[model samples]
Target chain A: MIKLAVPRGSIQKNVSEILADLSIDIPDYNRANRVYSYEFKNINDAIARSFAEKDIPIQVALGNYDLGIVTSWWADELLIKYPHLSIENLILFNDSVSKLYSTRSNDKLPLNDNLDEHIIVTEFPNITTDYLYANRTTNYRVFEAWGNPETWLNGDASIAILPEEKLTDNVKVIDSIYQGGLLLIGNKKNLKKIKESKLFKLLNEYKGLSSRSPFHFFDNKINDYVNNTKKIYSTRKQIRIAIPDGHAFRHTALALNNAGVEIKGYTDSEVIQGDLSNNVNMIINVMRPQDMPQAVSLGLYDIAITGRDWLKNFIYNYPTAPVFEMHDLKQSKYRIGAVVSKDLNVTNVNEAMEVWASQGIKKIRIASEYFGIADYFARNFIKSEYQIIPISGASEGFVPEDAEILVEGTETGATLEANNLEMKDLILESTNCIIGHKNLIDNVNPLIVDFINRFQ
Target chain B: MVDTLKKFQVIEQLFRDVLNANNFTEIRTNTVQPLNLYTSAGTLTPSMLHGTYSFLDWDGWSGERVVLRPDVTVPAAQWYLNNMEGQEAKLFYIEPVYRFIDDKNNREIWQCGTELIGISPETANEAIIKLVTELLGKLNLTTAIKVIITNKDNNLQVDNYDSLPDESIAKRLIKALGNIFDKHGFNYEFIDASQNKKFEYYTNYAFSVIANDTEILSGGRYDNLCEGLGGKKAYASGFAFNMNELIKLLSDEQ
Candidate 1:
């Protein structure tokens, strides 16, 4: 079932009417005063009433709900915080939303004044802060607001940032910071599903309902609910694990959970919410060799999983605290070997050596991903007679095309075979492995041990 | 007043004289290359990324890719695989290599080297040592040139250390050994059955020459290079001079 967040009160009625026009009957939404939640009778749709528009984006991003009808302003604001999440549908609400600005200064609001040193109070910090910063207005402070600009602006604070549509008769928009529009959004995965589902067609037909201009509004009811729940659940003992959303690390976490490990999974998005506070047990980071040493030095994760190639290239030169290989998952199949144009007459290493000796071939160029390996070959076997060309990816394609002989990683040799090349020699076969801090391995947590044991 | 040009002329003359006297030839190749060449070598691995530069070729027939030839051996071997018609050929080249490294190391290094393809092991070894020694002789450094040799058959059977997830520790250990050897003023040591370099291409003997803790020359017998390049069973051996290191050593002694 697709759960949706809809703004409560008047916006909720407007949404229900729009759904009704689309032949999606949402019953007793307005008549029933206690109806803060409603489900579609015909379609698999459930709507929870939210007093604040800001809650929709957060809910969709957190994967708590599948779909949401929210202002484009909020969607844009939330997307900046979670760039990985894509906006599903932009159903432009006919509502012309205006951004409101207020100043406590007795003098007229200075729209032209440099806002670099100004403090702007707003509950929507993500959007408002980014908008100001992106425009080169940096020195502004954002304070969370309880209800509206009036709540904060009328008090000690003079200036505030808020959605233009929320400007009421009591306050005026000194200048429209941005025009707020309506947007439909879902979780990235759910958005894919929604696009394939029949509901997408129904929503498109009723897009005209998006024409209504948004009314001045402000609500902190959702934030209050979430904060209170968080406080109550503070004792629950949440353990965080940072994993790239789609990497194998995330799968490993699931496998651990299935094996009875109670750990909370967090993506790059959720990391900024707060410190893991001794709760983060592991991080599975993937990057090239140059990044591994730095990542290890950060000391954020008790344990990390990365490639050995990274360890050798960077860590060998720079010493860091010792790390241990907990388990070798044997993934990311990497093989370092040489491949040449199929037409080359040489068939063995000996032949290649003789060619170097008698042919007056003073310099031989080998293309490979392994510079150290190439260096080793150049220094030892080829007697430093040839130049080793270091490449980062697609080493096989270099043969006869860009390079004479290519030294690269191969798994099934399908890429080489596809390119009409064959492996002349087999260098080494490798797979992804899991590693951890040396101290952590000794004081090994049961969860980590269990996770590592899976590979064993 | 002409001393500086004469010195530059001497350096150039020394390089040419050594190549001509050793029966070495020269070749010029591209400076920029594809990214996968180094990634596949198992030597540079992902960790030694400090010396290589990469860029995406958005306009070329090939899609976007990273480039900058970090070393010259691979490019020369690549040339042999494409141009050489038979299993037996002798070639030599002197070129500049670009590597990205931290500290005050030179990004561009001059490599004076030779490659012996389709040759016997004994002949290849003789050629490698002869070329290296000749190059050293041209520089006429006061320090002794020592060749430390190890056979691939004698080392541990581990393959491709660079691709390992925790390769840094092992690589560090090896580098430490190099440092230890340098500190003790040892000429050379044959690495026993337990120690093996990360590249998988060496099937025979491998060696590097060090002077004052700096690697002045390195070479080995790669009998498998021909077979790896889809050629007849052939033996290959060669050595390269760190022209930069050689120059430094020469200048330091003066």
Candidate 2:
């Protein structure tokens, strides 16, 4: 059975009208209705349910539905906010789409202003943050509001960001955060239900669809699903597993193959289309290892193969995040350690604190991509004042230029030495391992344990 | 937790007993099978293999891809094709079929189904429905159900764009399977599902026992499937009662 969430606001009428054209009808869908769902017929008919337009992306991403008729801008926002879900905009209802606009009291969204005093109210926080951060803008606290975000643009909140078409307030348009259309968006792993549905088949039946049609992502995935004749797993009950994209993907895939879990083309394909045993529905994908722990914790993925340092960094980052490492795959071994400028008079964190006291350094600046780890290490070890600076990458470039201390994971000290950096203290030794959510592990641990045993 | 496990055991045993009483011998097959067996059928229904617990079966990657058996029927068919070719087999199986719903939830579902191979068309259809009816009655579901029967001709004819459920032979067998089920005493509604249908495996007729907008039992006749897997051109029909769905029905009643 395919679960479909129909957008519930103004787009409701348009969607309902379009669905009517496709011969699928729903009654009292726009207004409140007592019925939770309506199905045209059993066995391949849609179980149409209603959800707010804003919530549809998350609902579909959570696998509550196979697909949703969500606006592209909201889909883009949720995609950014929850990157772990791998949400895809399958097809646009219309080629031309509306966009999210950043409207401010003044025409300028300052990149160099200390607007900690200012507030910004917007429905799309993640999109807005991405825009601000991309431009290196700072100091404006974001406040989330939906529908009439313009109403909150008076006192502390000087900026009102909303859908370009939705906003009628008197504010200057600064930028378009995202452009959108009514498209079919679904969780990548659970898309088989959508592909198998009459809805998808019906949508694809429209004219102008060609090999050159602008739907390579959806088309490729659909082709994969259609071609895999014997799917070993059923799409009805799903478990999406992720392998880290770089450095760890090959090792993880090898371990999975060794563990007797068959991921066809895991090590070869641009995208491996099917699962083991030849049937379908193993929702597995490759993602950056840095994103694995958070993705697993958020329930976006049931399990993931990630370096132990990433999990440690994530736990240090999100102390209350709901995830744990079930077993170590024992690959991609590395050590996260404290590294300092070669001129520092310290070989360890304790001595580094003493150096800070002797040199009368007021606050030690620790820079790392492992911000959480750096902060956690600072709280535990540094006796004097210290400020943890979060760096995106290039941990070696920071030491003497922007920071005095560096916390980073390294396999060899060649890069550190090349940059005139020396290891100060070892934080933890790490390896690639499988991590999963606390709530989800019980359901998938048996598979994980068995997969791990294949390596043994 | 203990209570749920006990309930699971009771439900499984109950299903096993029902299949046994119906003159069907239980068959056990491996949880894994060759990936090629499913694809060789050369049907659009191959998407059914979308998410198998598959891995390379040989060392360093060059090997037949294998998966934990997704559905018992295919493995059961391969078994019949290998061991009992040209022979009539009344087989029932109780096993767990794994499904990956997404990255989060996967079901290790216990499915109980019966396949009546080499049986006459009408006989196989009627017998399968009779068992399904009996099981529903046995379960004593608090909510009543509806069974919808859709003939395969109308099903395969609609949505010909995807060329499915069409075995390319004369009805081959099970031509009157729908007619036979129409005559059963149990109340059923017949619908023309030729447009936008989903029965990729059924050769002639498909039926679903639905309760509370959910399918409690469903199956179809795969007349040419045995032949596709190297068995004689025999008739086969079966249905599985999702134990979890059944328990959910009971739980809802409470």
Q: Pick the candidate with the highest TM-score.
A: 2
Which stretch of 10 consecutive residues in model 1 chain A shows the poorest summed lDDT? A229-238
Poorest stretch of ten by lDDT in candidate 2 chain A: A215-224
Clashes in candidate 2: how many? 42
**Highest lDDT model number:** 2
lDDT of 1 by residue, A8-97 (tens): 544666676677788876675556454445666676744444425655675566565677787666676656554555445446644454
lDDT of 1 at A394: 36
Candidate 1 displacement at residue A200 in angstroms: 47
Stretches of candidate 2 off by over 4 Å are: A1-412, A416-456, B1-7, B42-47, B51-60, B102-106, B154-192, B195-199, B230-232, B250-254
Query: Please, what are the lDDT tens digits per residue for candidate 2 over residues B70-181?
Result: 7777778777777777777889887887754454443577777778877887677567656665665555356545555556665443224234333432121122333333
Candidate 1: give its CA RMSD in angstroms: 27.9
After superposing candidate 1, which stretches have Cα over 4 Å from the reference? Answer: A1-456, B1-12, B40-44, B58-66, B144-147, B156-200, B226-233, B251-254
Candidate 2 residue-wise lDDT at A351: 76
